[model samples]
Target chain A: MVEPVLDVKGLEKSFGALKATNGASLDLRPGEIHALIGPNGAGKSTLINQISGALAPDAGSIRFLGTDITMLDTARRARMGLARTFQISSLAQEFSALRNVMLAVQARQGTSLRFFRPVASDVSLTEPAMRMLSRVGLADRANVPAAALSHGERRQLEIAVALAMEPKAFLLDEPMAGMGPEGSKALTGFLDGLRREAPILLVEHDMDAVFALADRVSVLVYGRIIATGSVSEIRNDPEVRRAYLGEPA
Target chain B: MGARETTVNVLLVLLLPAVALTALFIGEAFYITLATRIAILALAAVGLNIALGLGGLVSFGHAAFFGLGGYVAGVLATHAFNMEPVAFGLPGTTAMPAIWLVAILLCGLVALPIGLVSLRTSGVYFIMITLAFAQMIYYFAISWPAYGGEDGLSLSMRNGFPGLNTAKPFPYFVVVFVLLLAGLLLFHRLRASRFGAALEAARQNPARLAAIGISPFAIRLVAFVLSAMITGLAGALFADLNRFVSPSMLSWHMSGELIVLIILGGKNRLFGPLAGAALYVLFEYALGGLTERWQLFLGLVLLAVVFFARGGLIGLLAGRPRHG
Candidate 1:
C-alpha cells in the first residue's frame, strides 16, 4: 500500500478533567479526501487544532511526509507546507480578497523582508494570486475587501488563500459551514478535483457532500474514532449508526 | 490614496515651508524657529506612527528613544567641546551626520530589548510596560550626574553641518524640513512593501497572519525598532534645535505628546503627523497669546478630535482610508 501523506498515531488531549481527544489515530493517503465526521461535542475541532499546531496534544505523534511535526509551531508548520483554514472564516478583513491571497502567495515565496517594491504592482505575486482566485471562481470579487465579501465568497477566498500556500496537505476544518445548498454543491465539486493537488483531511458536517465526495470516512464520537471504513461500510456499521448516525441500536 | 487626499497632502506639505520661507523673506526669525519645531516634532511622531498607526502597537515609551537620541548628541558635543574621548578612548565629533548616526543606532539598539519584553503582551499591558520602560530611562537620566543630572546638559554651540550655517534659523529649518520629507517618504515606501502587508495583517489579525506563515511578534519587533530609529533621529535634531538635552525629553509627557500629535492629525494618514504638529504649535502660539491656560483649550480640541473626528484631521479632510 502507498505510504500515507499524513499520519496521526495515538493522539490525546484534555482540558482540565475532560478529555477532548483520546487515543485517536487516522491517516490521509495521497490523492484522497479523508472525511472526519462526528457529532457535536465530539472533539473534532480539538483534534484538528492539535494537528494544525494551534493546540499542544497531551500525547501524540503527527508525521507529515515522514517528518515529525508534533513540536513545531503553527507558522513553522505552515511554512513547511501544512496549510489550514479556520472553522469560522478568519481573514484580514481590511484587505482586498486579491491582497489576502497575495499574502499567502508571498508567504509561500519565502521571506517577507522585501521592503522597497510595491506589492500592488508586483506581477510575480499578483499573477499567481489572481490565478488562485480565478480557480476558486472569485475572479470578479478580487478587488473587493474580504470584509465586504458575502459569506460564501469569504469561504471561497479562504480556499483560495490555502491554495496559494501550495501545501502538501490541507487540514480544512468545516469548509462547508454556513454555505448554502448551491454554494455547497459547487464547492463539493471543486473539492472533488482538489484532492489531486494535495490530500485533504476534511472536517465537515454536510452529510450529502461527505457521502458524495469522501473517498473514505471515519466516524468519531466522544474523542474516539469508533469506526473507519469505505463510505458504504461506515453507513452500514451498526455501532456507528447508534453512536453518531442517531439510529436506535 | 485618492486624488483628493493626494491633493490635500501636497497642500499640507507645502504649507509648512511656505509659512517658514514667508517668515524668512519678511525677516521674522521667530516664525522660522516655530516651523523648525513643528518639523522636528512631526518627524518624531512619524516614527511612532509606524508602530501605533500602521502596526497598531500603541507604544507609550517612545520618549526613551527620543531622549536617547538627545543624550547621544549632548554627550558627543560635550566631549568634542572639552577635547576629550567619550568612552573607550573614542574621540567625539561635533559633526551633525555623526551625531545623527550614533543617535539612530543607539535608539534602534535600545528598542530591541524593550520591544522583546513589551511585544510579549498587548493592549493595556503593552501600553503600561512601554510606559514603565520610558520612566526608568527618565529617572536614569535624572540621576546620572556626569550629564548634569536633573539640571540637564547644554551645548556651548550648535552642531556643525557640511554645507550650511545651521546656527541661522532659516537654514536650520530647511535641513529639518528636508529630513521630515525623508521620514514621510520612508513611511510611504514601507506601507507599500511586502513587509508592510504582513505588518498590517499582523495588526488586523495576528492569528490569520501566523496561519499564513509569518510570525506577528517578529513583524512587530521590526516595526518597533524602525520606529525608534526614526524617532531617535528627530531627538538628535531636537537637541540641536534647542541646543540642550534634558531628562524632560524622556518624560512621560513627551511620550503623551507624541501620541497626541498622531491622534490630532490622523492615525495612519501620510501627512497626519505634520498636520497634527502644525496644529499643536499654532495652538500653543495663538492660545498662549490669549491666555496662560492654553492647554485647557488644547484639551478640549483633543476631545473634539477623539469624539467628533474619528480619524483625526486628515480623516475629516480626506475621508476614510481606502485600504488597511
Candidate 2:
C-alpha cells in the first residue's frame, strides 16, 4: 500500500476546562476523499485547524508527505502544499474575483518584490487566475467584486482559491454548509469532479452529501472518532448510531 | 485594449508636470509659492498613502519620520555652514542625494522597531500605538535643545543640487515638482507589484493570507518600513523647500494632517494624495485670508465629507477604484 499522504496520531486540543479534541487520529491516502462527519461541537473544525497549522495541537504528531509538520505555522504548511477553506466565507470583499485568485497564484509563483512593473498586466498571473475562475464557473464573474457573488458562488470561489495553491490535500470546512438544494447539487457535482485531482479531508454536516461523496467515512462524537469504515460498516455499527447517527440501524 | 490602457496611463503621468509648470507660470504670486508648498506637501501625503491607503497600516507617527528627514537636511546644512561635524564626528554634507539616503535609512531603521512592536496587534491598537509612538517622538523633539527645541532651526541658503541653483522660486519649484512626480510614479509602480497585492491581501483577510504561504505580520512590517522610508524622503524635501525644521514637523497634528490629506483626496487612488493636498492648502490659503474661524468650517466640512462622501475628491473626479 502507498504511504498515507497525511498521518495524524493522538492529536489533542483544549479550551481551558473544555476539551475540543482528544486523541483524535486520522489518515488520508493519496487520491482519496475522506469525510469527517460529526454533530455540532464534535471538534471537526478544531481538528482541521490543528492539521492546517492554524492552531497548535496539545499533543500527538501531524505528518504530511512523511515529514512531521506539527511545529510548523499555517503559512509554512500552505507553502508545503497544504490548503484549507474557511467554514465562514472569508474573501477579499473589495477585490474582483479574478484579483483574489491571482493573489493566491502570485504567492505560489515568485517573489512579489519586483517594483516598477505592473503585476496585473502580467499574463503569467492573470492567465492562470482566469483559468482557475473558469474551472469553478466563475469566469463571467471575474471582474465583479467577490462580495457581490451569491452564497454558493462564494463557496465555489473559496474552492477555486484552494485549487490555485495546487495543494497536496484540501481541508475543506463545510463547503456545503449554507447551500440551498440547488447549490448543494451544484457543489456535489463540483466536488465529484475535483476528487480526481487530489485527496480531500472534508468536515461536513450534510449527511446525504457525505454518504454520496465520501470515499471513506469517519464518525466523530465529542472530539473522538467513534467509528471509521466503509458506509455499510458505519451504518451497521450500533454505538455509532446511538452516539452520532441518533437512531438505531 | 490593454496596450491602449498602458499608453493612456503613461500619458496621464507625463501630463502632470506639464500642468504643474503652467500653474507656476500663469498663477505667479506668493500663490505660486503656495502652489509649491502644496506640491511638496502632496509628495509627503502620497508617501503616507502607500502605507495607509494601500497597506492598511494607519501610522499616526509618520510625522516622526517626516520630522526626522527634515532634521537630517536642516542639521546637515547647519553644521556644514558652520564647518562643524555632526554627532559621532561625521562631517556634514550639503548633498541632496546623501541626505535622502540618510533620511530613508534612518526612517526605515526607526520604522523597523516600531513595526515589530506595533504589528503584534492590529485595528484600533495599531492606530493608537502608532499615534502614541509619534507623540513620544514629538515630546522628545520638544525637549531636545540641540536643534532649537520648540523654536526650530532655519536654513538661510538652499542646499546644493548639482545642475540647478536651488535658491530661485521657479527653479526650486521645478525641482520639487519633479521629485513629487517621481514619488507619484514610484507609488504607482509599488502599488502594482506582487508585494502590493500581498499587502492588500493582508489587509483583507490575514488568516487567508497566512493560508496562502505568507505571514501577514512580516508582509505588513516590510510595507510599513518601506512606506516610512518614502515619507521620510518627502519630509527632507519639505524642510529644504521651507529652509526650516522644527518640533512642528514631529507633531501629532502633522500626523493627523497627513491622514486628512489622503482622506480628503481619496484613499488608495494614484492621484488622491495630490488632489487632497492641493485642496487642503488652497482651503487654508483662501479660508485663512477670509475668516479667523476657518478651522471650525474646515472641521465641519471634514465631518460632512467623512459622513456623506465615502470616497474623497479623487474618487468623485476619477470614478470608482479599479483595484480592490
Candidate 3:
C-alpha cells in the first residue's frame, strides 16, 4: 500500500483546560481532497496548525510521507512539502503579486540566499512565478502589490504563491472564506484539478465546495471526530445535523 | 518611479560630487572635513538602514558594532605606533584594508550573539534588549583601563590607505567618499535582490515567509550581522577621521543618532540615509553656527518630520512609493 501524503494519529492539543484538538486522526491519500468540517470552536484550525508544525501537539504524531514531523518547525515542514495557507490572508503586502509568488519560486529553487542577482529581471524566477499567476487567472494583476489586489484576487494570488512551491501536499485553512459564488466555483474547479498534483487536507466552512470536491469528509464536534465517511454519510449523520448543520436527522 | 522620487534620486547622486568639487575649488580644509563627516555618518546610517529601514529590525545595539570598529582602528594603530605586538603575538598594522577586515570580523562575531538573543524578542522587547546590550558594552568600555580606560585612546597619526596620503583631509575624504558610494550601491542592489526580498518579506509577514520555506529568524539574523559589518567599517573611518577613538563612540546617543539619520532620510529608500545625514549634518553645522541651543530647533524639525513627513526627506521630496 502506498503511504498517505499526510497522516495524523491520536493528535491532542489544548489551551489551558480547553481541549482544542482531541484525539484527531486522519489521512490524505494521493490524489484525494479530505475535507475537515466543523461548526465554530470545533478546533479545525488548531488541528491544521499542528499538522503544519505551527503549533505543537500535546500528544500524538504527524507523519508526512511516512516520516514523523511532529517536532519540526514551520519552515522545515514547508520544505518537506507540507505547504499551508493561513485563514487570514498572509502575504508580503508590499511586494507585487509577481514578487510574492517569486519568493515561493526562489524558495523552491533554494536561491533566496543569493544576494547579487536582481530578482525582478531574473527570467528563471519571473517566468515560473508568472506561470503560477496565470494558472490562478491573475496574470494581468502580476505587477500589482498584494495589498493593492482585491479580496478575491488576493485569494487567487495566495494559491498562486502556494502553487509556486510545488507542494507535495496542501494544508488549506478556509481557502473559500470570503470568496464569492463565482470565486468559490472557480476555486472548486482549481482544487479538483490540484488533487492530481498533490493530496489536500482541506479545512473549509464552505460546504458546497467541500461536498463538491471532497472524496471523503470528516465531521468534528467539540474537538473530536464525530464521523468519517462519504459526503452522504456525513450529511445523514444525526448528531452532525443537530450540532453543525442545524437540522433534524 | 514617481517624478518626485526621480528628482530625489538625481539630487542624491549629484549632492556628494557637488560637495567634493566645491570643497576642492575653495581649498578649505574645514569644508573638506565636513564633507568627510557627512560621508562617514551616511555610511554608518546606511548600515543602520539595512535593519531599521529595510529589515524593520529597529536595533539599538548597533553602537556596539560601530564603537568596536572605531576601537579596532584606534587599538591597532596605537599598537603599530608603540611597536608592540597585539595579545595574540600578531603584529598590529595601520593598513586601512587590514583594519577594515578585523573590524568587520569583530562586528560579525559580536553581532551574532546579540542578534541571536535579540532576534528572539520583537517590538518593544527587541528594542529594549538591544539597547540594554549596547549599554552593557558601553559601560564595559568605560571601565577598561588597558586602553586608557575612561580617558579613551588616540592614534599618533591618521591610519594608512594604500597609495594614498590619508593624513591629508582631501585624500582621506576621497577614500571615505568612494566607500560611502559603494555602501549606497550595495544598499541599492541588495534591496532589489533575492536576499533583500526574503528580508523584506520577513519584515512584512514572517509566517508567510515560513510558509514559503524561508526562516525569518535566519534572514533577520543575516541582515543584522551584515548591518553591523557595514556600520563597523564606517566606525573605523570615523576613528581615522578624528585621529581618535573613545567611549563616546559606543554611547547610546550614537545608537539613537544612527536611527535618527535613517528616519530623517526615509526608511527603506535607497539614498535615504545619505539625504538624511546631509540634512542632519547641515542642521548641526548651520544651527550650531547660529546658536549653542540648536538642539531645540533640531528637536522641533525632527518633530515635524515625525508628525508630517512620515516618508522623511526622501518621501517628501520623492512621490509615493511604487511597491510598498
Candidate 4:
C-alpha cells in the first residue's frame, strides 16, 4: 500500500448543540484518488476545511507527510504542499486569470515584496503560471479577467491556481458541483491526468463520477463515516446501501 | 494594460505638471497658493491610496498622522527660527529634508499603535475605531495650550528651501509640485510591487491570502503605517506652505475630506488624487464665489458622483482598470 500523505484520526467538530463532524477519520495515500460522497450537509467540506487548516477541529490530530500540521494556519498548510479549492469559487475576479495563477506562483517561488519591476514582465512568475493554465486548458484565456470566465472555466482556473502551488495533496471540494456534462467530463479527464502525481481528496455528490474515478471510496452520513472501501465493496455493502445508497441489495 | 491605456496614463501625469506650471505663470499669488494647497492635499491623498486603494484598508484617522506631521514641521521651524530649544532641549533645524524625515518617522510611530489596534477589528469596527482615534488626537490638540490651542500657530516667514525663496508663491508651488510628483511615482512603484499584490490579495480574499502563507493583519498593519507616514509627509509640506498649523488639520472633517479626494479622483489610479484635489479646489473657488452656501452644492455633487460615477474622475477619463 502507498504510504499515507494525509492521516486524520478522531476528528470532531460541533456548532453549539449540533455535531457537524463526529470522530471522522480518513487516510489519503500518495497518488491515490479518494472520493468522499454523501448527500447535503454531510460534513465533507468541514473535513476538508480541517485538513486544509481553514477550521480547527474540536478533537483531532492531523498529520501530513509525517508532520503534525494541526496547529498550522491555512496559508502555512498551503505552503507545505496542501492545496484546496473552495466550494463556492473564491478568486480575485477583477484580476486576469493568468494573474491569479501568477500570484500563487509568486507566493511559492520568492519574496513577493519585489516592488521595483513590473510583475507581468517577470518571466519567472508568469511562465510557471502559464504552464499551469495550459495544463488546465486555460492558456488561451490567460489575459481575460477571471470575472469574465464561464462558471466551468472559473473552476478550471481554480484548479490551475491550485496546481501553481505544486502541492503534494489536493482537497478539491466538488470541482464538478455545478458543471454540465461536458464540463464534468473535462474535469474528470483532468483529474485522471493529475491522479498519477498527487493524491486527491475529492468531496463530491456526483456518484457516477465518484465511482468512475475513486480508487478508494468513503461514505459519510450525518457527519460519520458509514463505510470505507474499494468501489465494488462500497457498492455491495448492505449497511452502506441501507444507510446511504437507499437501494435494495 | 494596453498601449492605449498606457498612453492615457502618460498624458494624465504629464497634464498635471503642465496645468501646475500654467497656474504658476498666469495666476495671481493667491491662486498660485491655492494650486499649491491642491497639490499638497493631493499628495496626502496619494499616501492614503497606498492603503485605501491598493491594500483595501479604509483608515479614517489618517488626519491624526497628517496633523502630527504638520505640527512636527511647524513646531520645529518655530524653535529653529527663534534659535531656541524644543521640549527636550533639542534644537530644531530648518532643513526641508530633515523635517520630512522627522515627520515621516513620527507619523509612522504614531500609526503603529493606531494600526495595531485597528487591525484587530475589521469592516465597520475598523472604520469606527480609526475615526475615534483621530477624534482623540483632535481633542488633544484643541485642549493643549502649549502651541496656541485652537487659535493655531503662524510662521512669520515660510520655512526655507535650500536654494530657493520658498516665501514666493510660484517657487513654493514648484517645490510642492515636485514632491507631489515624486510621491506619486513612489506610489506607482509600491502598487506594482509583490507586497502590494499580497496586500491587495489580503483585501480581496483574505482566506486565500492566508492559504498562500501571508498574514492579512500583519500585511495590512505595515501598509497602514507606511501609508500614514507618506500622508504625514504631505501634511508637513502643507503646514510649511501655509506657514500655519492648527487643530483643524487633525479634525475628523479633514480626514473625511482626504477620503473624499480619493473617491473624487478615482481610487487606486496613479494621478487620481491629483485630479480629485484639483477638481475640489476648483469647485471650492468657483462655487464659493457664486453662492454663500457653496458646501451644499459640493455635497450634492459628491452625492451624484458617489451614486453615478463608480470609479470617479479617473474612471470617467481613463475607463475601467485593466490591470490588477
Best by lDDT: 1
Ranking by DockQ: 3, 1, 2, 4
lDDT of the candidates, in the order given: 0.94, 0.85, 0.91, 0.86
Worst 10 residues of 2 chain A by lDDT: A109-118
lDDT (Cα, tens digit) per residue for candidate 1, span A41-100 = 999999998888889999989998989999998898899888999999999999999999
Listed for every candidate in order, the interface RMSD values in angstroms are 1.2, 1.4, 1.2, 1.5
How many clashes in each structure? 0, 0, 1, 2
lDDT, candidate 1, at B138: 99
DockQ of each: 0.76, 0.67, 0.79, 0.60
The residue pairs found clashing in candidate 4 are: A75-B210, A75-B211
Best by DockQ: 3
Q: Please, what are the lDDT tens digits per residue for candidate 2 over residues A135-214?
A: 98899999888889888889989988999989888899999989999888888888887877879999888888888888
TM-score of 4: 0.94
lDDT string for model 4 (A35-153, tens) is: 99886788888888898898899998999999999998887788888888988888877788988898899888757767667787778888999999999889999999888999989
Q: What shift in Å separates residue A104 of candidate 4 from its native position after superposition?
A: 0.2
After superposition, the stretches of candidate 4 with alpha carbons farther than 4 Å from their true spots are: A1-3, B1-27, B84-89
Error of 3 at A170 (Å): 0.7
Better of 2 and 4 by DockQ: 2
Candidate 2 colliding pairs = none
Clashing residue pairs, backbone N/CA/C < 3 A, model 3:
B4-B318
